[model samples]
Target: MKILFTSFLYLIGGFFTQSVAQPARHRAAQDSLTAELEALRVQGHFNGFGVAIVSGKGVLYQQGVGFADAQAGKPYDLHTVQYIASVSKTIVGLALLKAQELGKLHLDDPIDQYLPFKVRNPAFPDVPITLRHLATHTSGIRDNDFYLSKNYYLRPGLPLAGLPMTFDATQTFIPADSAVSLPEFLRNSLTPEGKWYQPKGFSARRPGELYEYSNVGASLAAYVVERACGQPFPAFTKRYLLRPLRLRDSGWSFRQIDFARYSRLYGSTTVPLPYYATTTYPDGGFISSVADLSKYLHELIRGYQGRGTVLGPASYRELFRPQLAAGNFEDRNERNPFSESYNVGILMGFGYTGFIGHTGGDPGVVALLFFDPTSGIGRILLLNTSYDDRPSEATMYQIWNTLEKYQHRVGG
Candidate 1:
């Protein structure tokens, strides 16, 4: 399965109960975990970082290190927000499912029913493109080959949208608003009359047959959500998910966050990268902090356990549906913990039980958010630098080891 570059404000977890009445042993474990994270931050030279541990009940431990603004000397903290890149897919996926729960749309319906234009694989026009195909990376909508097409920049007459059209994940700068909006881009690309139209965007394989990752498919799904739900994607999320959960610090864009607490992204050089924005906000535009994310994690764990959650439990099951075909190659290695099979938007594999979450990487950012619902434990890691494909192996190994240790101690 292709690795996708791969929210919230809430108070669902047991923050108060654990803080006021936690057993002494659990508190000691948290202290040691904090120290180890500090050592890892120092040793790895993380520019800015946030880490959190969440169990079924609530956040067990959380911390931050380095700087939100390095030159200005702003210390990174739990409230610091960072762009999560492809991880935004998970949020979009959840929202789409929620739309389904509200009777706004059905996952099995042909996407064209909700879109202004039809999108059928040119090679197999008889087949319908469904929302399930989009969520699972099985829609056969591949990204533009910027190297060959030099189509990175959006143009007024271009019928096709480029990879950058998906979002500003690795783009040096955000595009102007005059550029094609996500819905316009999708309509143009999917409709024959639109400029920049090319049969190449669609794969020769049948929809739901192959696993080519496509940001186009993801953002397209969100547009469908907007059309079906009668609201902008970000606005809908805020109304139904963010605000209801009381996630005041997490949002769909930088403008929604506190500048002082927004982490500066870094590369190998001393200069920091510019923040990103996207017309296709559904793809990779969400920004969040560990504190906010923990609440969401708790909800995920709760849903996995068939309990209270912001998104319906049935929706959670759909979100975590394994999308891997029998023959697909797994990406697991010493550096990667996920199985070869991909889920709706999140990945699967990790720990003794397993995990469901996504990893993200862009020019100057890397992040991981996953939870082992079986163990009622989850982890969130955010870094301001894209140092490697994944974070350092030592850091990951340490995280798993810590989880195992903590799980054993708590008899989870």
Candidate 2:
């Protein structure tokens, strides 16, 4: 009698468990997201664009729209690669953090410790600039104002000087007397001995005390990583992050990758633009496809979930958190409390508060990669054309709304 009663209780317990638990959710359909992206491509007059949805385990879906080569009639596919612009900065950030984890460098170390040249804010030479400051854009560094300078075109090997003229017929190219390497560009632009040195390339405030956006600072950080790690920046990054993440369709240089797979960039007028590279490759130089980046984002999400081995959990935790608070720049629109070199506290589109990611834009490209650590879901969008006036904030809002509503949730 006792055994029969116990078996009855067990059966009842199992029934209750089945009744109370949530039913497994079928994966959302991908058709809606694909159709929406295609519509957006048409509406925006984009030459080509790619979108991807990712979760902790892997990519949910990735789709490409429009023509990679309108003349050739090559329809853009998930494998069509293009420059991701400033999005590359985030990769550089991860590389630097990886270096730190390997005991190759420290975040608080002074710039002079690793850089071949001594770089000081001319206004506050007494205050030292640290890697932390550079990563947070608080290094008191500023843009070169290159176009306004006489020698801007005179540095033959300085890629930035030639890029504008190469891509736009209206822009004039002045011939240079000599070629300059990446290291030379930095030395000339920052040191007192170099002719291109300008006092205006720094803020009046001390390092780590203010915010000023700077490509120079970011590129410098990458260079420091290379010096500390005893390897070229691109090589180190490939071995450490790209190879491990299986982002095979990504690279920094045109010479290194399969150029045939590249999506030719377009202007607002639908004119194909010339391919241009930069000496500051670390700052805004990433050529990739949606499929490749989806893998990268998944790995990043895994790290956030404490299951990643590529980077220590503590490092990934600090990567997105606000590194500086007082006097830090905060953008309510992005829900970014502060800007780290590669990470931001993003509040938009993730369906949750306190998400993180980065955005990138150049003359003819715009890309965004964002993910929520709490939910382990993320979105990526890449466009291959630029307008006379950059797209407004409304575009991002619409994108977030659409993805939030339609993206398939997998394994959640």
Candidate 3:
């Protein structure tokens, strides 16, 4: 018995020794990554950004470099919050599948069954647009000029002159109070009976025939979730997705988060953009941070691996299942590993390189959230500045590529 007990003690001692050594190595790798990222930031055009390296196990590394507010000299750290633009659509994807799991709706069901108003492709008014079509960006819906001109509303009390006019003229900002509700906005933009409707609001192709990325279509899917589940989109997502993930810093609007931590967005290092909100909030308005998103990405990685807690194994399978083929896209990006347009699964994206995730860019926000299914490693980049020029855009890619190079080392 004494001999057995000493053997057990030695085994325990060896375990502790290895555990301590692993973290020490991890810390050294993290420090090296941090230093390299900081150097890249100094040379890049973005004012500030946040990053995370995660795996199915959990967050491997997370950090923020540069300034959240350059004028104020506030460091953009792990907790600095900002909108992730279209990356928000991934949460909508989760919500849709969760609602489906609860028997509220099915992906193949025609959207008109849930929406208060009817939506049909004028090109094929007889063809029903399914929730699946919407999720896969093949619903034949189009984001017409009205969507660009009317959907964005500037937050109250900002000096208009200080906003970046050169950023995008079509992304016009109106008064915040003038903004309509999501349902109202969707009805007007999509239905011929509504005022903002355009003949080109829908595509000529039949539903599910072509892949045309539409912010309006994405938001409409979320609205369907709301109607089927009998809860507002924000409330439903918060209850099922955010609360479960313990993403305390993420929400659909500024009101739901600590506004003080919100990073000031920029068109460039010198061009600060005024705060704005999207009526189609589900498509591009999710506010979050590197620290919180790391956890969410970790959950997604686990979900992809069939061990997720948020939904059943079946739902995760559907969520990551590729929904498109070569013919779905008019022009596919066959080269860009980060291009989400290569193929789609529900709303989750598949890159040409087999990376599964999404990429998002708004006026002042650029975000990339992708994971390698083979390695179970994921990376996130959330920048608070726009990369309008080629050099700046290349720098953004450089940052992502840098994370790619180090993710395996840090995550292992």
Best by TM-score: 3
lDDT of 1 at 157: 30
Report the lDDT tens digits of candidate 1 across residue range 1-412.
1132321100111221246577878777767766766777666556678777777777777777777777787888988888776677777877888898899998888998887678888898999999888877788887653211222233233233322233234443324444556777776676678675677888888888876667778888888889999998889898888986778788876667775677877763254655545555666667888888878777777877877467777777766666565443233232334432333443222221246666665556666777765566776777776454245544544543554455434312
TM-score of 3: 0.93
lDDT of each: 0.65, 0.66, 0.82
Question: Which regions of candidate 1 are displaced past 4 Å?
Answer: 1-20, 146-178, 327-336, 339-353, 388-412
For model 1, name the residue pairs that clash.
Answer: 8-247, 9-246, 9-247, 14-58, 158-195, 159-195, 159-196, 160-196, 330-340
TM-scores across all candidates?
0.82, 0.81, 0.93
Question: Candidate 2 on 140-210: residue-level lDDT in tens?
Answer: 98866552232223223433432344434322334554334567778888888987788898888889877
| Model 1 RMSD, rounded to 1 decimal | 6.3
What's the count of clashing pairs in each model shown?
9, 0, 0
Model 1 residue 203 distance off true place after TM-score fit, in angstroms: 1.4
Q: Model 3 over residues 113-146: C-alpha lDDT tens digits?
A: 9988999988898999999999999998888888
lDDT of 1 at 312: 74
- Worst 10-residue lDDT window, candidate 2: 7-16
Query: What lDDT does model 3 reach?
Result: 0.82
* Model 1's TM-score against the true structure: 0.82
Task: In model 1, state the lDDT of residue 105.
Answer: 94
